[model samples]
Target chain A: MDPKVVNDWRLRGQRYRLEGELCDHCGEAIFPPRDICPKCHEPAKTPQTLSGRGEVYTFSTIYSAPEGFEAYTPYTVALVKLEEGPIVTAQLTDVPPAEVQIGMPVEMVTRRLRTHGEEGTIVYGYKFRPASFWHASTQA
Target chain B: MSSQHLMQPERAVGIIGYGSYIPMYRLSSTEVARVWSGGGRGPIKEKAVAGLDEDTVTIAMEAARNAVARAEIQADALRAIWVGSESPPYAVKPASTLVAEALGATPYLLAADFEFACKAGSEALQAALGLVGSRMGDYAMAIGADTAQGRPGDDLEYTASSGGSAFVVGPADLAVATLLGSLSYATDTPDFWRRAYQHYPRHGGRFTGEPAYFHHTQSAASRLMEELGMDPDDFEFAIFHQPNVKFPSRAARRLGFTAEQIDTGLLSNLIGNTYAGASLTGLSAVLDVAKPGDRILLVSFGSGAGSDAFVWEVTERITSRQDKAPRVTDYIRRRTEIDYALYVRYRGKLKT
Candidate 1:
């Protein structure tokens, strides 16, 4: 892995925390944020951190993982639509791949992404877990 | 108070809010037993497994978020962040910094990692108490988390599990639980240890008994009780370091605490031993249902042969924050059982 790739990830640490941009003009939420809003085609000027809650828009289970992630073969990857309005793709966690569903409520959680080696750089990122798992039986 | 006394803060400080995270995946002992043997045999029900993307850093981050929510305080209010984990993602780098960054607590704060086998979390809490009580920080976050590992086919494998708990510590006046006092007892007795560069720890088997877990836990609890002039009967609930169901249950009984006193906090039976997270998670469960003014006792044992014990009183403010984060029971109840093959994968036991 390129040291630059890991360094570049450091710049996007805010993404791991759900920090994004809100389009002031068009009232849109943009993630993996950009200086210009894709919707309004203007500067998204306003900064916003998402509520970190969303629903699974779509998902797939990867039986054959990419390099460095083969140990987690048959894992769920989901395209989550945030409550704010951006669709972010992340790995689904906590629950098994078979349990992931469209529209399933989820919440962002920080986790290790991949490690270069025992003595290598380890990448960390965000993943989603079912929000219902937390509140399911505890709600009054 | 005597001038010569145990280490404790003069100004009261305690958990203003707390939270825990247990990975959803579980592997039953029976499944593990089936692999080593032809049939069934093991100590506990099941143990949690961190997914491929999860580690102590991730576990602490989740727990910290929930704790901040329950604390109803901005993450920036935390002046220091201490994470206790034997299985920190990096051996040299501090997991605390990453955790603080992820939680939006950065730029100005103290941060570090602690390692003392299982009681590392309690060790962090002790530091938090000192920081907040001395007014150095209005609030501090102490976390105990781990993705504990055991050698294949080893007894520890049945119980070594993954999970974490976080506590937001602040002045007792605003705390959900008030820490009356706490004490620690430690010695160089090595009942368990993993050398540098070692993958799994080596234990002395039965030697981990009588001398390590039992002696340290019993001594800490007993000494705290004696110092505070309190007894087992005075407390409503008691939590002990649970390396296994048998150890805690027996320790509680030997300490004169009834089964009812320890049952609410007894979780290793379900989630297995969470190492640094074990006792704190147990305490979190007890705090979940404890009524205002209820007294609770917590004693955690780490296998360097040491224990940290504390007596806390539930405050009226607890009710307000109880619902802010998911209860420990919620995590315990929400689990998906997996087979051994998947467990091996989830634990990354496969040779690449």
Candidate 2:
């Protein structure tokens, strides 16, 4: 494959997990990362990473169709409370909505939410699925 | 103190009174999308989010004050205070205390944070009514508030807003919306959620759809209605948990509710999703018009577990009391628009 010609985007981010730049000065971890420490008011930051492992602090099942989300009409959007105390919202997966339990164990998985209509580029990010699927991909 | 003669039995635990509050400043959805989308989400609009300085407690206090201001009961009458939210500012301490202190409610009252996605507030309300009506307490207060956020390019980022609503329940005259009947159901799995420390959470895009929200909400709601032996057409106003302007509408129709019935959801489309307060705020908007004799049903669904449903009957006390609801419509429409860059700063998405 041509070094730059072919899209080398991997199945995951910097690691099998998400990458972040933490301000050694401010103790703030920036995700999708950055070089400067915004909270510390410093232009210096170091690279750090996370396991993408966490629990579901809170969430909601969005039963609607927005502009881009038409194909996935009624989805469960969750506000995940990371081990770090920062709550991130994402789409909940695996366990059916009827079976989604609060404080239930969850882990991260690379999943496809949607692909751009105009551009064929597929947007991929971390999503929550049943913990049972943590190591069990039924691809067998 | 039990009432066997109550004319409207649906909302036996009626909201004897209600109140709300929003900060002076505003941030539109257009501004939010622009910052994250590198421009905008096409004709995308900006939704309002709260500033870093303010948190859930501050917003809840403001709303609780208004709910009690016009109520017939005294603050000392409340036996419990529950703060419902997903975006609780502090993880260790209790948020209900701050709200309780701001409302001047008794300190001896039981207080805790209610967690259940956007349905927390309604869930809290049902529980509070249980405490009071079941003789556990004489009166109780329930508050729902949040400053919900999502990644910039993410669809939820634009529609999430900040605000709160409060209800005071007691065995009093009629200023309060009465609670009549209540029901709930749940499924044990991960529909949506975040960890305790992550700055942002994860989700299952397609799986979250009808299977999670619609199925659970409709299933639980239908079960509640069926248990009550009532149909969807029974109530004048129906309030549901709101994730975005587009959400409740689609879910409502899917569950066999009509456009007119769910039109009140405009409150969410305009204001943004207030995490736990989303649907309760819609109900508060409905309470804006609900007459004493009118019947209302409040339903809340939290991902992860299940739902909490409470039926309310509007009371004459509501009529006797002057209308104090700050027109959410007015607040939603009044936009102090901001560019995408400013929104990025607010989201702290773009570090300086």
Candidate 3:
């Protein structure tokens, strides 16, 4: 694991609260917030905390585990369309890979992403769980 | 009664909100015996298992969020956050700080971690009551959660499970259930223990029965009743720390509580013993069905051993606050069962 990846505590607010920036000119929403709005070509001054509620735009199940995530193989990764007009990529949790659908409603939850190793610092971040809009009972 | 002096507060305090969480995956008792070559006889049918990414911190966060949702107040209004858990993610870092930050309740709040076996949650609850009762804070949050552990083929394996419960304690006017009074009893009876740097706990086997669990629980419950001049018949419902189904039932009978009074809170039958979260979760379940003006008795026992007993009266506000978040039964019903192999993988019990 990269040293920088394990120590991303500097972005705690952005990651934990989904704090993004909004373009004051074109109203463009940017996550991992940038100083410059890509669409308006202007400085994004307004800060926007996302609703943390979204819909699954697309998804894939990883049968082969990644290098740092071997313990959690066969997990679902999804592209979620935030209600605030930005598409964010994240790992889907709580719901199994087989049950993930393109239109599933999801809400963000803080969870452990990966650890460096047995003694390494654990990386924690936001993952999406199926929201109440989608009936958990309906999922067969 | 010496215990009467410790029971109620000058100011009324009660639970403003409460929440509970159970991980989705489950492992059946049959699968446990199959993997370890033990007989199929087990204490309970199945136990909840924390996923690879889930632990005490994550479970606590979920429960706290639900509690805050039901609380209907700004998270920052919480002046303190205390978590009681035997399975904190970090040995040094406080789980309460992480939980507070995740819930956006940081910068100006007291945070700490607590441990006392299964009664850890009640310890935190007691402190929260003090903070709110004495006007130290308008509200405080206390949580009990664990990702319990057990060595292979141990009886603890059949009972150790994962879950969490949280309560927002505040003034009685804003409360769902008013705290009538509480009492605690402790003795240096070593029924179960886990030393620092140890993964799983060791128990004194049958010694846990007569001298540890039974003694403390019976003493605490009996003392609380005697102090308040009340008995089991006074409370509409009663919840006791459920190491297994049998201990609580036996303790209830000894304390003169009938089976019906303990039935709704006996969640250990389905989710196994959640340790710190055991009695708290049972209390949450009881509060879900209890009506206004109903009285409840909640007692939690932790090995070493000790018990904290509280008398609560359900308020008219309970019905309004319950629908704010998912109920305890909702989490229990939304489970996916896993086999022994998957359970081992999820728990990270596989040795390198």
Candidate 4:
């Protein structure tokens, strides 16, 4: 049992499906659920799945990536405001960095984040893509 | 052998929803030829390529999400989630579990991966139909996806593409296309194989044509149609596993099908050979525009020398559910062409 595997396993709910907690007291959405409400400072444990739809609040294009991510240099990382009222920071994929806009609509998709060399676990999590206007309208 | 391996579930089953996912990147055959052959074009026009962060599991997840959306069923209701791929990221770990967990079909779901070359997707579909038809589950999802691989300069490089399709099989009454019957024909003729630990596959070249793909494909299709007493004239569309642009056309003609019948579903020229996703993606394309009462014949060929032939009749429900998710043509229309350098880098052809 690798510690990295265990750590990733523990956060599978949030990474894979955007599982967040809803404040039962104040109705505020909390991402990376800490079991305690930030708004009312009360115990909040109601699990809620997000719609995975969002608009980019801001983004940065990275010319120099970290060690494992060197192959994907010049990738875009964005602060996406999820439709459910939580702002999550994640990588933007399937769209060119030059094309990414601050207010562009995006939708979550599962993607390979990285692998541990050749024999280690391949970490998969949610990434956002430019959502088609037709698709977004239909979803709305 | 007298029964011809014809299989039908005790209860009727149908496809409640269907969806496909083609990656955003495209690499033209010209690029491969320019780098390797120094000139001339390859077989097909272009092929889809997975992004740096996309693979079999990610493709399966997206396609399954679309299927769930079109079915309008809770992901937890799926009793089985099966993925068929030739290029799974892990050789040992199961890609199906990741897909199931992401879809929220965890804990109680039957999750597994299947491999049978190109027809792997149809194999999963057959098993899903059986699961739903036997009353073992109310709903089951079968996905065929691949980020297929090819040697750097091999002929396969031109056509081994990336994409996949998924189907949600459930009760016949709730279906968009009802499964009438199916038959499978297989033999030990090895037309293509990738030994354990090998990064790429090898094919029998000319041998893949007559004895393997053609033999199994025609056998299963003819036998299923014979057993069901149906002919080419009865089907409105025909889909065949496409390793290239020519094989399916030749198979359809020899099997008494017309060019018009197979034209709507012939997608290999655009997306190249998606292997496990080949025929399933073609079926998704056909399902996009098929009308009520239209009968369809699908035959899938796997290199292990097997073919799964099925007869499906579209139901009235197809009209209402067709727009619930993005269509196959929509994915095809959305494309970004990349050079050979980026393709090799994204596909990991170059050792970093």
DockQ of every model listed? 0.69, 0.01, 0.48, 0.58
lDDT of 2 by residue, A2-83 (tens): 3321332442333224555667776876665556765667865575555456787877877775765555545677776666
Residues B273-308, candidate 4, lDDT per residue (tens digit)? 999999999999999899999999999999988999
* Model 4, docking class: medium
Once model 2 is optimally superposed onto the true structure by TM-score, how far is the C-alpha of residue B163 displaced, in angstroms? 1.3
lDDT of 3 by residue, B198-293 (tens): 988999999999889888888888888887889888999999999899999999998899999999999998899999999999998888778999
* Best-fitting candidate, scored by lDDT: 4
Q: Which ten residues in a row have the lowest lDDT in candidate 2 chain A?
A: A131-140
Residue runs of model 2 more than 4 Å from their true location after superposition: A1-140, B1-12, B24-26, B36-46, B172-175, B350-352
lDDT of 3 by residue, A40-79 (tens): 7999968777878999999999888779877777889999
Runs off by more than 4 Å, candidate 1: A5-9, A24-27, A63-66, B1-4
- Point to the candidate with the largest DockQ: 1
The Cα local distance difference test for each model comes to 0.88, 0.65, 0.88, 0.92
Angstrom error at residue B110, model 4: 0.8
Summarize candidate 1's per-residue lDDT along B182-215 as a digit string, tens digits: 9998999989999999999999999999999999
Chain A TM-scores, all candidates?
0.89, 0.69, 0.87, 0.93
lDDT, residue B36, model 3: 79
How close is every model to the real structure, measured as TM-score? Answer: 0.95, 0.66, 0.94, 0.97
Task: Determine which window of 10 residues in candidate 1 chain A has minimal summed lDDT.
Answer: A7-16
